[model samples]
Target: MKTSESLLAELARSGKPIGVGVIGLGAHGSWAERSHLPALRAVPGYELTALSTSSKQSAERSGQVHGVSRTFGTAAELAACDEVHLVVVAVKVPHHRELVRTALNAGKSVLCEWPLGNGLAEAEDMARQAQSSAVPTAVGLQARSHPALAYARHLVADGYVGEVLSATVVGSGGAWGATVGPRDHYVLDAANGATLLTIPFGHALDGLASVLGEPEELRIRTASRRTSAVDSESGRHVPMTAEDQVVASGRLPGGAVACFHYRGGMSRGTNFRWEINGTEGDLVLTAPIGHPQLSPLALEGGRGTSTGLAPLTVPEHYVRVPELDPRADAPAYAVAHAYQQFLRDLREGTSAVPDFAHGAARHRSISAGADRLAEGGRIVGP
Candidate 1:
């Protein structure tokens, strides 16, 4: 009978729990298990009540593994459950639109993973649904929650680093080119699935856009494409449709041009680094410690001083919020935090970010980039 805010405050003060349902039971879903479930258990106001999977067996397995009270064979069943006030969709790109619509239409809040939809049309349609339904929706853009990046932005805005001149982000190391699972096998074919370009590249670019602002001109070039030794479920070498290595250049609104070099299959160490250049100084954004490559919603940066680049410490505030299971050292826990934030925004009446519009814009960028590649690397916008 308590109001949502009052309940949240009470939970924060007394360690109560919020009821939540999670959809999908794959690697990302398993992430929900290792990360979200524990974090939600640690948070003040959260509870894992239900989970849904395409197969009942998978749902049962997830339910047992995550310690959830119930398991539903389908997303709709989970959405309609009275015990579930929030739904977390960690499914594939293809199923996002339908599962999200189901949860929203069922009067449940939703937290969907990245790339809201596979294409612009799907993202636009999903956004329209979110708008019309008035249901709170959160997309996976956790990098915005990072603290080091936050400090960088603050320094930039405050002119600690003078007006931005230009920037470049290079994310290299490891071979994501090899097909990992049955669900992601489609990714090798650009036409069938969203590959590094749409998934990892999107995250990298989002980080870039977050610090630099929207780009005025964007151009993309893929060096080469070839099938790897990785075999798909179909027993054939999945055809690599998109370029595994891509170089995208863009001019920020302030006339600062940025270049991004991404190599999926490389021998270098697994590192994600970004740099921002200005008239006064330079800032190097490095992956934060404590959280894994994908988990740190917070980041770290190096600011140039008169002598050398000084370490800029940005507090990790995004994961600091109190939850039922307050365990650290796990990146998967972020998905739960991301989910809880989505529902918290809904219950608290704040604007949900990376909603339909954000997803649509990214989708547009993807489509536009593909078009440019087809047209021999011309500039385009989404």
Candidate 2:
């Protein structure tokens, strides 16, 4: 088997845009259409060559709508296509394992969305497959690629905070509220693997880990405040088993305390706020709502005896991809940066972007924490 280095070198030497095939291109209001399509368009070195949907008719229709000629009804068909150099799994969480495996088995690179699998086992299995395939892989944890967050991470590392002491985060889920949409009802079921804990809280935690290091000795508590929600469109009641509130507190490396609290639904004030306090300084990140991976974030900091926090502008160099507004609230902004990083990794044979292995590690951490929570215990990290 060719090593990852050799495969990247081969792709670099080809001097052609990578042909990408995306699975589960729904008709409308799909993430693929909203974020992935626009992101792919914004970044160079990639071509949307093929796409697949649940049926041949829908696939052809989406192909025409997206201006792609090659469409398939099955992921296997798209993965086998000679024109497809990269296979993107953009479907629901439950379908990730099957589609990702199909692409990996066909010896194609893959870019799977976050919450990489239904749970830890599936994520580990996919990670093992990607390792054996020796191909480039990426998971959609775009919050780490956000320019503001990236700059904040650098600031923390550059001693702007002067030895981290503690961090606190509070955010709203934006879903799991008193009402559910027809398209989003699936997330209400804990079995569906898109619960508040796994989506909004999970993304925010990952972004926090990227900056403050992973939380250790974690104590977690979850509650479902709203047992049922009314369907906004149909006036029908839907049972919600997923936890609507999650709280976790722990210590980061270097003995800094970390605490997170996420609740279901939006708040009239302070929908998202994160503050990192240190011996000599403090940094704060905020957004209109939670899901830092999707929303734009603002950074503020005060260091060395400053009276109050002030907005800190991210330098232009942090916006690795040009021609895109980093401050836009659109989902495509951070996604475009992620795609640029992935392209750079492929060309330079670097693993800058989070891959399947990274996703699996995150899954393991979450799963372990959840298990301990179930046993009414705290998780002690390695």
Candidate 3:
């Protein structure tokens, strides 16, 4: 794991591309189909060599449609695939434990989609198995790898925004509200563990932390204002246990007070807005949609003597995957950056990839604060 060169050069030297096996890839429509598959295609050193679904027929159909020659009906079969160097687990939360452990036990590296497991214990178990396997692991927190966030962090560190004073973020949960499709019905139940607070807010938190560092103190308020959602398919209303609105305020590093608010579904007002103010100037990030992980964000800021906030174009060096147009699929673009980083880590033993340990840590942070928020907790210092 010490070789370092261009991806193609490294692949040429090894005489083979990095083989990736994807688990939980559905036959037709899925997040994996829309994001991971395209992300792998945009990346240079990896190929989708194998895929898995709930059944052999499904696996074959998915593999065939995606041009993957190998298909397996179960996680075990895919885990044992000799051609697979990395196992990408794209299944839902409840299934993350078994599939990730199976792949880790098989000695294959893994890239698990975010919220690594259904809960902290599950996430901890996955992280434990990963450590014992001694293989590279990555989580689905793509926001940490976004080029826009990277540029914003550089601006903060390079004195573009002198010692940060305060940061505020207001976001909307585009889908986890009013109603949901049959495929996404599971999210309405908090027990399913992929609610608005965990996925959208969790990713936004990741990006916020990456730019400002972890918070030292926090206050939170959360509520399930919309307790029911209509079933898009059945035309039935389902009771929801998960919170639809989240409000949090905290003191981050550099004594910056961070405030964040998110509500379920799209808002008539701004759907997404994150502002960082400092002694020198202020930076703002926005998008038409609320999910920063899935939507492209444009950066604008104003520094000393600047009349108004002007657009700041992200330069070329930070754009890791030029093949991915931010406008076309921002989520996939961010995902590709993480995938490319994992390939680099696999080659050079770097730690750029946010592994399951990071996943577990985030689970703890998100779950802990969310629990407190649900209880209407007040600000507390670490």
Give the number of the best model, judged by TM-score: 2
Candidate 1: where is the Cα deviation over 4 Å?
1-17, 26-29, 173-175, 178-184, 231-236, 288-307, 316-330, 333-349, 372-382
- Report the lDDT tens digits of candidate 2 across residue range 308-331: 999999898998777666555368
Ranking according to lDDT, highest score first = 2, 3, 1
TM-score, per-candidate, Cα-based: 0.80, 0.94, 0.92
Q: Which residues of candidate 3, in runs, are more than 4 Å off? A: 1-15, 372-382
Measured with C-alpha atoms, the lDDT of residue 248 in candidate 2 is 85
lDDT of 1 by residue, 1-382 (tens): 6543354334434544557788875424455555555655654467778888888887887777766658889999999997876688877678888899998888766777777886778888988887777655667765554444545667778876687888877775233455445545556656644666767677777756766787766877664444452554665554555556777888887788888777654434545567788877877765432122254433334444574676755545634554422235335444445545544654565653466667778777766765334434422210
lDDT of 3 by residue, 1-382 (tens): 4312243235534647788899987767798988898899998888888999999998888887888889999999998987877889998888999899888787777889988999888999899888877766889998878888999999998999888999999999866677777888788788988888788888898889988998766666677666677777898887777778888888898677998898887888989999999989999999887788878989999999986899999999999899999988776888998888776676675776688999999888876775433434322110
Please report, as a residue range, the 10-residue window in candidate 1 with the lowest summed lDDT.
373-382
Candidate 2 ranges with C-alpha deviation above 4 Å: 1-9, 12-15, 327-329, 371-382
Residue 205, candidate 3: Cα error in Å is 0.7
lDDT of each: 0.64, 0.86, 0.83
RMSD of each: 5.4, 4.3, 4.6
Local error of candidate 1 at 138, Å? 0.8
Candidate 2 lDDT trough over 10 residues, lowest sum: 373-382
